[model samples]
Each structure stands twice: as C-alpha cells, then as structure tokens.
Target: MHAGFTLVEVAVVAGILGLLALTMTSAFEGMEQARQQNTAQAHAEAARQALRTFMLRNKRLPCPDNSTYGDRGREANGAGSCPGDLRVGWLPYESLGLQVPVRSQRLRYGVHRGTNADLVAPLHGAVDGPDLEGTGGLARALATAAQAAPSTDQPHYSGAVPALSSDTCASAEPVNPAFVLAAPATDRDVDGAIHPGFDGPNRGFATSSPCVAPPARPATRIYDDVVVAESATTLLGWLSTATR
Candidate 1:
C-alpha cells in the first residue's frame, strides 16, 4: 500500500486552499467596486451634459423631479415650474428627455429655487425671447445669490458651515452650486444605514441645506457620495457664447 499524506501536510493543503479562496474573493470584490465607480462616473457625466444641453436649448434649467406633481422623472409641475418648497429632489431625467430608468435614476438634484432668482424660471418664456428685461438678469440672479451670505437664497451641499460674507475658505466653502447632482455610492458599508453624505442637509430645503462638496466629511465616513455642481459663472460663460 502507498503511504498516505501526513496530518500536517493535509492541514497545510487546507490552509493554502483557504488562502486561495480569500484571495479570489478579494479580487472579485475589488472588481465589483471598480465597476460601481465607473458606472457612477458615467452616470454623473451623462447627467451633467444633459443638464447643460437642456439649459442651452430652453434658456432655463428644468426643475428637479418632485414625485407628487407628475411621473418619476418629470418635473414636479409638468414643465411649468417646480414647487417653491421642493428645492432638492430626483433629477428630472424624463423631463430632460433622458432614457435612464426610474429604478436606476438615483441621482439627487438641487437648485436655487428662489422666486426672485429662480434658476428654473423660463428665461425664454417672454415673447421677446429670454427674460423680459433683455438683460442677463436670469444668469445674474444665480451669481448674486451664490456670492451672497448664507441664507435661503444661497445654494449648499455639504456638512461645512457656510462661509462668512468676506471669508474665503475655498476648500471648505460651497461656492459653485448653481445646481448640484449627487449620486450615492453602491457600496454601503453599513448596509441599509442612512449616510449623511448621501442623505444629509445638502439634499434638503434651502433654509436647512448645507453647502455641497463631494467626498463629504467625517474622516472615517464610508460610501461617500459623488457630487457635481454647476456654477453660475460657468452657466453665464456658456450663455455668453450661445447663439441666442
């Protein structure tokens, strides 16, 4: 009869197999994470381009998709206007004519929805074409509010306190938020727990909303959402070059 393997040899073989399994698992997990990140980036980029195109064509930005007013992706009021109180909501993908499904549309969008400076206000509504004043009033309004002191008029997206009127904390401040698009990361570390970076003040009403800057705070914070903002400066600059 042939001699069989020793006990230690069996144990060593088992340990090696275990290590191999662990390595394979880790590799798969890493691949999944990368895939999720890539998909999130692609979605954000596509949505950003769509928002810009819509603004260019309509001369006004479409409101976020508030659910009560219409379908899952349509504007709250069917292209008329967003509810004054609903500052943050889902991106109006359908309203923007986007093909993203309701189930896959996880992007949260927020805009400066002030009546005085409504970014959703139809600048082209006037028969004269663009705003009635014929001045760059629409774009100017957003710029003014974004630069003003922290208040209902200003846009915010993150946990940091809004900067003082004169203070310049470029890194901590939320300066470029004419509108913001936030996508929650797929890897929820806590599994079903609400993440502040994904559901916190940044996605709330104007009075309570915090300034938005992505990879949000708490040094150990996991699953930080991806956020992209469109600033008034950029919008105005684009408008300046448009064929209006």
Candidate 2:
C-alpha cells in the first residue's frame, strides 16, 4: 500500500494554499482600483471637453444640476441668470448633452462666481456690443490678478491617505480657478460611508472651494478625490480659438 501523508504535511499544505489565496485576492483588488481610477479620469476629461463644446456653441456656461431646485441631470434656471450664490453643484449632464454610465460617477462642477465676472449667466447681450469681450474680459482680468495671489492655508489633518492629526495647515486652496471638476474616491475605510473630508473642499456650494488637493488626509479623513481645474485664460483662449 502507498504511504499516507502525515497530519503535519496536510496542515502545511493548507497554510500554503490559504496564503496563496490571500495574495491573489489582494492582487485582484489592486487591479480593480487601478481600473476605477482610470475610468474616473477619463470621465472627468470628457466632462471638460463637453463643457468647452457647450460654451463654444452657446456663448454661456450652464448652471449646475441642482437637485434641490429641479430635476436631476438638467441645468437649473441659473444658466440664464443663475443667482450669484448658486455657483457649485452637480454637472448638468442634460444641459451639456454629456453622458456617463451612472449617476454616481457624475462630476461635481463649479464655475467662476466672481460678481465682477459671473460666468454662468447668458452672455449673448455682452457679445452683441462693440467690444466682443464682456464676461470674457472680466474673467481675463481675474486670471491676470490671480497670478500673484498667495496660497490659502486652512486648518486640517496630516498624511496623504489617512489623517493622523488635526493641527496642521497647508496651502490647500486653488486661487481664482475659473472652473473645477471633481470625482469622489472609493470608500477607503470600507465602512460603507464616505468620509466628509475625502473630497476635501469639493463637497457643496458652501464647502467647495475653487480647487483642492488629492489623496490628502484631514483628521482620520480617507481621501483620494480626483480633481481638475481650468483657468479663465485657458478657457477664453479656447473660446477664441473655437470661434475664429
């Protein structure tokens, strides 16, 4: 008869198999995360291009899709004369004719809300006058003035993936950004709830700054929010090029 394997050999084999399984699970998780990151970046770029196309055709920026005031995926009345306070909200996919796979992946949008150069309102009248630059001029001026602006230091936690403390402050603000697009990251804590600071200052109209840092931690905050910004100069340049 063939000799049977000892209990020690069986235990050793079982442990080795368990370790291999664990390693494979980790590798798969990492690959999925990379895929998600790439998809989010592509979606953000698409949204940016769509905004440019919309502006080139309409001569005005669309207001964000404010679910509180109207239906989802559509721009609010603000596009015509968006209230000065209504500056940041969900991307108006319907207004821009932009599409994405699901609502969860929709970008958060923020337009330049300077009183001197409100960008969300219709610019038809401005373009009708002798000086073809109306809101465009104001935006240009803001962009120029912001060239030497100082960075904003806000109180927040430390670390890149998870905050270890709460007494630190960094130059965390984007000065005079003409527009910003942000995509929320996956739940790093895996607690089924998104941490408040994960998206940094890109949360809401009140909390959303012109821009924010990514993968930053702010006091136990799990963060990896992807963000993109367009300067007024760049936008006006594009508009000029597109119209010419």
TM-score of each: 0.73, 0.72
lDDT of 1: 0.60
lDDT (C-alpha) at residue 233 in model 1: 72
Candidate topping TM-score: 1
lDDT of 1 by residue, 1-244 (tens): 7499989999999999999999999899767756766676678778889988887766667877766322477787777656767667678888787875544336777777654667887332333455654345666665665565545334564335433221122334344467777765553343332232243333333123434444333211244346677777777777767745
lDDT of 2 by residue, 67-122 (tens): 63223777776456566676677788888886534655667777765544556653
Q: Which ten residues in a row have the lowest lDDT in candidate 1?
A: 162-171
